[model samples]
Target chain A: MSNRREIEREAEHVLRELSKHLEEIELEETYHVIDAESLRADSSPELRRGFREAALSIAPRRDGAHYVAEAGTWV
Target chain B: MSRQALGEAEENLARRFEEIERRDREINSFIELNPHAQEEARRAEKLGGRLAGMTVAVKSNINVRGLRATCASKTLENYVAPYDAVVVERLRREGAVILGMTNMDEFACGSSGESSYFGPTENPSAKGRIPGGSSSGSAAAVAAGFADAALGSDTGGSIRNPASHCGVVGVKPTYGLVPRHGLIDLAMSLDQIGPIARDVRTAALLLEVIAGSSREASMLDVEPQPYSQRLSADLSGIKVGFAKEYEEVTSPEILGVVKRALRRLEAQGAELVEVELPNLEKALPTYYLIVFVEFFSATRRYDGRRYGYRIEEVCGEEVLRRIMLGSYISQKEYAGRYYRRALQFRSLIRRELLQALEEVDVLAGPTTPKLPHRLGERLTPLEMYAYDLLTVPANLAGIPAGVVPAGRVNGIPVGLQVQAKPLQEQVMLNVMLAAEGRA
Candidate 1:
């Protein structure tokens, strides 16, 4: 688990580096919290897409009055 | 003598107390076992009700009024619940004495229950093995006999995994069947408060107290069932579907045990059939992506604000990871990409489950693929995500699921999962009780 180091070059974005060091697929890996200021001035559509996908998965979807979200999988 | 049943129960409680004192030191199954449980037991006996003298341990996530709901995380440390969680309030209404709040993975994140700031909970069934978690303490509390039953939350497999590994009964009620108002949210859409007990009948009793509508908080958005109190044991002609997707994901040993249990159900008169839940294979990644994003949003309130703890400062490893992922995913730019795709997949899975249920009354399988791991055994987030293979469908479909002790594999107990359609707990429990040979 690489702790965020804000040294000569500060970085933003949760370092996807934790994705390395290969562990068992069912195991829990460390959550990365980056400095708020480190966020990229601009994000790629790919990054945006991943986050959007994740968000819609948990976000409540409402249609007028009824909560129409029967889509996301339960954890 | 009905009143005196309390006295006898107190005596039983005393004996159990001595045992908990002796065994608890080794298992650490309890975060807090009320020192006055016996007195409360006697009082409950005098109250004279269905659960009058029964002892219940609440998961740290469920509020017990004066007791703290830490969600087993340091984030909520020192935060005693100002009011009772809906289930706790219901338990109190029924004359049930809460033993104490049990430990869990912080913020209900880990499957191993190792992410607690207090300490890792040990598996009660097989020594040196992890009590499957998120609901580690809740299941272990019952497995260790520290409490008669326990209320636990299952976002994914928290209750079922621990119950499976600990040789106990754990059930995740259909979402909305039980209110969530007082319970802390991990992922509001997915988090469900449930019961962990030694047997299915007792679990039903606890569910009775906790399930239903409150004036303000209806755990289920709609009343799925009027009462989950009286689950029938009759599965004579019920149809049980075995999901084809589970074959590639389940362990042979686990499946072998589950198959025997299914055969037992068949012998008891259930019709076994093969069913398809095509999207279930994608449910793990889909569930994780959703949990990460939502959990992050839920924790945002804890940024050293009105909430008790700053997660970045005090939350455990799994939680922080999720917060980051959740926060990342919820950002404006990424709104529809990853989160939407997962949601799309989520919809597909739910559609598949509903279609499968149309053909069968319930589904059955091994709750978890692998057996328990030792404390500190490193596993990747994806691997950790795999444990919910069998459980995600229930959550995704917002249905009730029961995990009973099927038997053991290499000394570790395995859970046989029985799931049913939304709000159909009786049908689910009937299938499960028959399957577990509880009749």
Candidate 2:
């Protein structure tokens, strides 16, 4: 737990220094967001099948056609 | 070239494979050798493209079909890539034989190569010293002649850092200039997959092949240029910029070596101009803030559900540190204080670099602030992060940067970094060619 705290402290120090520098610079609030839309072409049937097989090849848990994933918990 | 010449080239490649098997036991540069490399070389000889008969090493973070994309971590120890990365696909089409996947700093987290789970890569050039990371093996492989060239991705100096330490040329193309479709990236916005090779022309040729528009990659609108044919040693009218901030951070020994290289460029008729970047100190902190957030987000995919082990459970200390810090910084309450501000600083630094480049063609500096430490030497995370001080601004600004062997400091090779404006790889490669001539 102490080790975790030390790491947190180190992160805090870095962030605090950055915060100070940010305050010194006077710039308008600007948002630079890259559009998240996928520009990739639709995969051909063969390509899609290859991708599915490849994905299944590495999956730790999978049924015949479905990949098994851990349930997200809100707690 | 005749059939006999082609046969000789195949024979040379066969000998290189033998050399890798023999020499890489100590260097640990390759994570795995391609079983089909000889057959691939033979196929390349018959097909004959731009890079025909040239063998290449791939950094483990980039996908090469059927090879383990481990990122030097235990988590992905068995995750074989499903398909070749766009770059690898391009290399295959251009007739370059894939040598194999090489080692790296786990999750591309460390500047020194020591953090790899497979064991640290030794500096083949410096002997017993560290090979800089996280593209450690790629550069070392080229340096030790394991491959004619190699592919390495630079987020914050990963490619050039190792290239500098290993005495080879490494390039980080403009962020959007090279596609990142299949890279397991550290920070997506900053990552650019580039070439590491024995000389400038080979690096330029590799860059020309792999850099172009791809629907798989977003924001990559820059058309690929014929970089190799444009190379010239005559720098009669080229303007090179030097920054005091870079010198202030660099050790005197490394700086002196860099200064001598600058003088050589001057003798070749290149003009050196002094430029100022007042917010240079802020770049390191800004770079880390963004990397932490992005890396944390990227690692969320490794939950042991679909592929690989849950990263947090099996990653190295540096990887976990970035993950934890990234998680903390991405919190809604703290995001504005850290991550968002870092983005604004990124813009500011980009503007500063573009402004500086207006007066000068390229900026030259020492690739690393200090020489690489000895292998297994313990350093605090901050100390390790400082190694990227001289190289991160280029990434932050999304510019093309390349490192050429400058000279030596205490028998350890130093690199002179040349950074050009975004999509100005030809200009950057030309300066690198001049430095290579001096070297």
Candidate 3:
């Protein structure tokens, strides 16, 4: 099974590719972060860990689950 | 053109203003008609393109910055929004003037618009018939010609139901197509803002302007292929699938009209296929459980804290019913049994719709099974809730659906609902155009 990380990576990669097709389209912003603990808080730690693993596929982690990227990072 | 256009269109404003000013008295349509719409309509004439500076009425649940977003309930009766909802911001950014706010069921819990604190909005159809609620005023305003178009929130059957009863056109875009930021959500997973108008073209035009990705509504990250395009090809070979079980409980007059519509489509070159969905049996019970739990949870912020009046003190029957139901469903061990079952049922419905659309192009049915009910007849709550049976499945499926005036029965209008697969709005809309004689 391609885990959830693989899925997010694939989605972000396809979006970045699609943005190049048109001029003046609103590809000016793209923000993808997968933080299960801050968003859910009380859920299972394992589930949070799973989402943390998924985050690795989308963006490089800074500290813990927080990740940030500039708008229009889809290039 | 800009401000100069308002100067030019000044002559056209007097007549539209007088008509809205006259009819809104009886219908309870506008919470507040913008004092500036007439003044702005003059500027609108300078404006060009799709909307042409047309004015639009917004639902009370959506924000317009400093305007009140009471949601027709006492709890938020005094509330003023601090920011525009993404849709409202887009409308202004695109030059479609915001006319004013319209009334709705408190927290969008009712089917008859009777739960609004502003009082039950009179249906513009039969004097005694319900305008079919939650989006009641929004529908009544469009039918009475108060504005060119209005924005309404549909959770369950809110938008399509009223459109059916009031004899207008309304479209709920595919979920996440329109943004949710600053919408006082009735149910987060199901509520969507869409255009209600006199024709499908206007609905499509508004959808085109609003159907794009937004940063605030993170789920709305991908822009849809522009929704306004009308397929030039004939609908002759398109397949329409309908559940035969839908025929079991609907009224004869309403069913007769919907059947006639299907027959008309058949004569026009489209092929009709009979489809069966067995899981449909659990849709109703499941719908309430989810709505009740979510509604119950969403109201926690209204404890006389930030917004309007305290809920129980001023809320009407429908609002009270939901709060009470939400409390009961969320109590003790009943939480998972009631709420989770509903979510599971929602997933099942989504699966069935996706599976059915695999072979058929669209699903065809009466937007509502029953014609508008009499205004004062006493009925059980469940009887009223049953009106949503045909419509909620489409919302749960996260697909685009619309109701156009199919025909009249017993002097009230009936709607033909057409639904397409997730994100396949242009396809379904083409089919609706064919049924509405636009083809």
Q: Model-by-model lDDT, in order? A: 0.77, 0.89, 0.76
Quick one: best DockQ, which candidate?
Answer: 2
Put down candidate 2 lDDT per residue, B90-110, tens digits, no spaces: 999988889999999998998
Give the alpha carbon lDDT tens digit for every residue of A1-75 in model 3.
224344344433322332222222222232457877657445545345577667756785354566655444565
Candidate 3: residue pairs that collide: B5-B42, B5-B46, B6-B42, B6-B43, B74-B309, B75-B308, B75-B309, B76-B308, B77-B308
In model 1, which runs have C-alpha deviations exceeding 4 angstroms? Answer: A1-75, B1-4, B35-39, B218-232, B332-335, B437-439
Listed in order, the DockQ scores are: 0.02, 0.23, 0.02
Worst 10 residues of 3 chain B by lDDT: B4-13
Better of 1 and 2 by DockQ: 2
Query: Model 1: per-residue lDDT, tens digit, B1-439?
Result: 2666655767667766787788877777667666666667767777766677677888888877777777777778878778887677777666678888888988888888888877888887888989988899888888988888899999988889999989999999988888888888888889898999998888877787777777767454554343445566677889999987788888898888888888888877889999987556677767776787788778778877877767788765567667666766678425355666666666767888889989999888889988887887887666776777778778877888999888888888988899888888888887766656431
Worst 10 residues of 1 chain B by lDDT: B219-228
List chain A TM-scores, every candidate, in order: 0.20, 0.34, 0.27
Q: TM-score for every candidate vs. truth?
A: 0.83, 0.89, 0.82
Output the lDDT of residue B135, model 3. Answer: 90
Who is ahead in TM-score, 1 or 3?
1
Candidate 3 residue runs with Cα over 4 Å from true position = A1-75, B1-13, B42-49, B231-233, B437-439
